[model samples]
Target chain A: MLIGRPSDITASEITPATVFRKRRALIKAAGLGTMMAWSGLSLGEEPKTKIQDYSKSSYGQEEKLTSYRDITTYNNFYEFGTGKEQPAENVGQFKTTPWTVSIEGEVLKPRKLGIEELMKLAPLEERIYRMRCVEGWSMVIPWVGIPLSSLVKLAQPTGNAKFVELISAADPATMPGVRAPILDWPYVEALRLDEAMHSLTILAVGLYGEILPAQNGAPVRLVVPWKYGFKGGKSIVRIRFVEKMPQTTWMRAAPREYGFYANVNPTVDHPRWSQASERRIGGNVFSRRTPTLMFNGYADQVAQLYAGMDLRKHF
Target chain B: MAPTSIAWIKRGIFLLALGPLIRLFWLGFTDQLGANPVEFIEHSTGTWALVALLLSLAVTPLRLLFNMGWLVSLRRMLGLFMFFYACLHFLAYLWLDHWFDWAGIGADIIKHPYVLVGFLALILSIPLAVTSTDAMIRKLKRRWKTLHLLAYPVAILGVLHYLWLVKKDISQPLIYALILFILLLIRLYYRLKLRRV
Candidate 1:
């Protein structure tokens, strides 16, 4: 139960965007075209793009950034595969180019936005945030994206819309894990309308000064830092605004284990394991286990969203 | 059995039983333990303990069905190896996880039912491991046979320990459960047959 976190991953480096495209091209040339546009499929860049870190004193920023390898490699993207290493190895060829996110359902301006349009809508900023997984392993990652509020404003949700539902891309042909019945395919996660519109919530497009590596949710993915990692669905395909609370994937899969709020509360333990502490990922072999923070240490900004609600129940 | 043949059989099984420990050391040395080494070590050791425990249980059926007395000689080593790995598994949790936080550890034991069973299984194994000596066997002949029967419930508790801890994927633990069920069936079938005879 007390596993140690490592300091920074040092395995295979993320395949650079150019190299990835060339590989996809080579695979196509070799009659493996079906594996095209996966992982590092980049839409054209925004003009004169620059990424800035949203570093602050009170943030749960670790002194050392988790190695890019660990952040990208060890993931819970079951779409690609089930093992921790499965997503890292299998997501290399997931077609993300020509991808579209449908922003419909309860929004006044329902529309489909191309990847380029999505990236350009808001300037991407790098927020080095600490990510705590429901599995009790945690990491500090620098995510580059725009605020979810900005995107929600663009969608123009109707007055009655009370929640934001996100659906991810889960193609059985490409994502082999979808073949297995592990939580309903094409994973769905949701947020209360205010939580979705919170400034801290972002639609992350990139990380480590480049487009997001495929394993870390390529093209576009949600980043609700306060919630558990699974709540942040990767390789998103849909964003729906609904009047009632949408049933999220984990909650639907195991109602007792995963609550809708999924807030990082140490007191509310998963039925199988305690949430009191987590292993920090990266660094030493015997990395120390530290106490998990409330709201994953984002209490200052997001606590008000649940000021009156009982988190243990919602969780 | 001749003295030389008996020595060879015991020695061979003893070295072969060290497989998991050897592989774990190799993985640790090569930095192949993956993202979480503590968990990797804990799981590997615990799984191997279950395997050894189940295999040791299979010995009686193997001996009875095949009428092979030699298989009985392998049981003591296999059963002790189960305890060997069980000790490592418990220590990994006690040292690596709790880090001597007696208060926290005590509270955790009471809090998690799965941990309680796992803890009880480890405590119960000590008597079995300690009394597995040749001298103890001679001192308490019929009683030794009856006392070792304690392994039956211990195996079920061990299987329950595994089945409870898993999150979503019960397949891994279920596989262990299936094997335990088959082993128990074989024993019950043989016991009824022998009683009828």
Candidate 2:
């Protein structure tokens, strides 16, 4: 839906070249001998440069530079204001220093993990991905985070841990949008354990290699690429493992409108708009409209997981 | 007041009526509307259309309730503004969202209930707008009044379209529905009063 020429994003402070060079330097400085060992063994006949190529592809091409910093910071969380830039301006009042993620329900530990402790569990890696908003606009963002599986493993999910529900902080004093009943405060997002373990699911801490801007979920947020952006709840404060499927914020607001599996499939049209195609963020205005892929183009890795299930029914 | 002064005031009012449309165009050109400029344009114009419709509906009630005869003069202008915004809204959806894919858009209208209602509301507004001029109003007098009655149904359909569009959080839509219901009730009361008289 974004019309007119794209903004001159060339002035972006976080360039792809800088991120690539930094990643290579980080890999070398870490003395990741284990990574080298795995890289050599996993790729039998493939050249050593193949792994670099794979990383490059994931990082995104330098030519197109389709990736961008996730604009959740410029979010209309609505409690703050209706403007997209309001959250970034107003969310500074929120204090994330004393933040703690409450892990409970089906987890064995059932304790709170401080933000610093959580960060120490796994080294952060930047993953550049195309983020499509249901509103039809999109962004390519380089997010810094560890896989959700890493955090789930730290808590030690019990056999009963079937679903993971994430809850955002709900203090109206900070998140003014919480004052209104636009949605139940402390927004919640849930995913199945298998889906949580899918390497793509991340507990993001930063974007563009900088500490996350308060508007962009600040301390931590969920990043589920296969689903629409809303599935990735921002400003997260609590994470609970539950046996039964947890009630998500959007699903509770309108069950008919939002389904539990909010996957981005072009075939399944949103009741209001068709999902058949998406305008890539930084592509050519007229010729760049790309056909949206099923499972957000993660079909090769994730489609079989839902093998016999009816997508439309679930959707 | 002198005749020339009154004429100048009338011309000034006409330009004032053009304010929102000019602002919309300026915003579109400035790129201050956000990432999805087309969607922003569509939403802005659609919101303005709803506001104009509400304003137009208020005219009769204001005249009857407050005995303000001058309010009747503004009704046509408000209705025209609603039509103008509706045109921009439809154009944005057709050009940007559908990329002028007529077949796909036609299929969408048939398949999607929300799109169907939205398209129906838009189509119905066209006749009302076309018959809004003083000449057309006089030429088809009785038929013109009857055709403009379609605005009530179109407004209802417009609200329904909004309600169905949102995936979650019905608060905004519900507020609009409440306002529309009250506006319709006022009209119903006026109609009943006229019949009794």
Candidate 3:
């Protein structure tokens, strides 16, 4: 399914640069500035992001959030490009408006929905989630979106629907990396039906309380905090509920390396790298890598999802 | 070329070869290394090591192709520079990336094929670097020529290290592999021509 930006927000609605800068200055003067202000580290000028109202949730409330610059700039949305910085640099022309997503296969109420309809399905919640990449790096991002469970409830899946596949957009006009066979076009990821219905699984629309940037999978993307970051398919185009476990893009590309579960388990190391520890993305060179937590420290919330299964075998 | 002129050129090339490290330090001080500073440092050092290795490998072919006997004097410096960057790259992985966690490092080396190959390449380069001095080279004589042939395997392993490290989009590593291939092919052609003569 193809999902675009919410229909309500228009070009004129974006805050003017002058006003945005002035407001930022005021926030700085008021001593209510963000991490960059306190750290005295220059991570370049923060991008002018579109802000939206989102109710704060308790998820990752105690954890320090990664800087907005790092969160946006250091992305792995391969559709834009393969390099971490390429997504932000190459997403200039990526259009997210007028997008629609089709929710089909094994759903009783399978229907297509515009990006706005999806946004309005539930109230936006700002969930601070620890996103861990399979490459042994991580970030604590304050994501703004509704839970995927809300949308699944709306779809009213049939009893036979055992898994749900999340497919990404692969428009060659904007997504330059799709031209190369780096990965199968239209990146796909899947989760067991129960895993999809978990409350922690969110359909992220924005991050840092702003409209999602194209690099960070603007409009709509999956945010499965318990799994490696790659499992959260960016810029989703379709959601297919199926009876059998669906093969994913990474699985097709390198089956031995990437697994269907892709769960964040420190004990089960990736074939090429140790998953025991992850370099916190915003940390300086001297900072010690933090030990990776079970289920990314969301074990209390997600471990039960894989209770009986061997993560190593699945991984 | 005059010995004096060549000596001056060697000095110039030494400073020029130091450019990558200087640039790295400048970027670090300027806070321009982006989000993951360690990764940026690691990638930069690793890339320069390979580049220097390729340049050192090219010296023989380039000198033979141009019939410039004076070029052989510079090969030692280039090879040493490659060793220098490779050391820095390994340090970045050990100190910066893994923080001297020997257990973790050992596990990583054993678990990953790419890491194993890279580690092997660096380990194999040590003897060449140690025996690089004029005294050792003069003492070893004929055996030194045979021993220094280790350069070919080191270069091949360096290229493979990069080729295997990447997940997909092997374009960058592929380019390095192609250059290494052509460099080896040129040397083989020269060897065949010498036999014919």
Which model scores highest in DockQ?
3
Model 3 chain A worst lDDT window (10 residues) = A3-12
- CA displacement after TM-score superposition, residue A87 of candidate 3 (Å): 0.8
Model 2 segments beyond 4 Å from truth? A1-57, A62-83, A281-289, B1-10, B167-179
The candidate that wins on lDDT is 3
lDDT of each prediction vs. the true structure? 0.81, 0.73, 0.87
Candidate with best TM-score: 3
Where model 3 places Cα greater than 4 Å from the true spot, the runs are A1-51
Report i-RMS for every model. Answer: 2.3, 4.4, 5.4
TM-scores for all candidates?
0.87, 0.82, 0.91
Question: What is the fnat value (0 to 1) for candidate 3?
Answer: 0.72
Model 1 clash tally, residue pairs: 13
Error of 1 at A132 (Å): 0.7
On the 0 to 100 scale, the lDDT of residue B85 in model 3 is 99
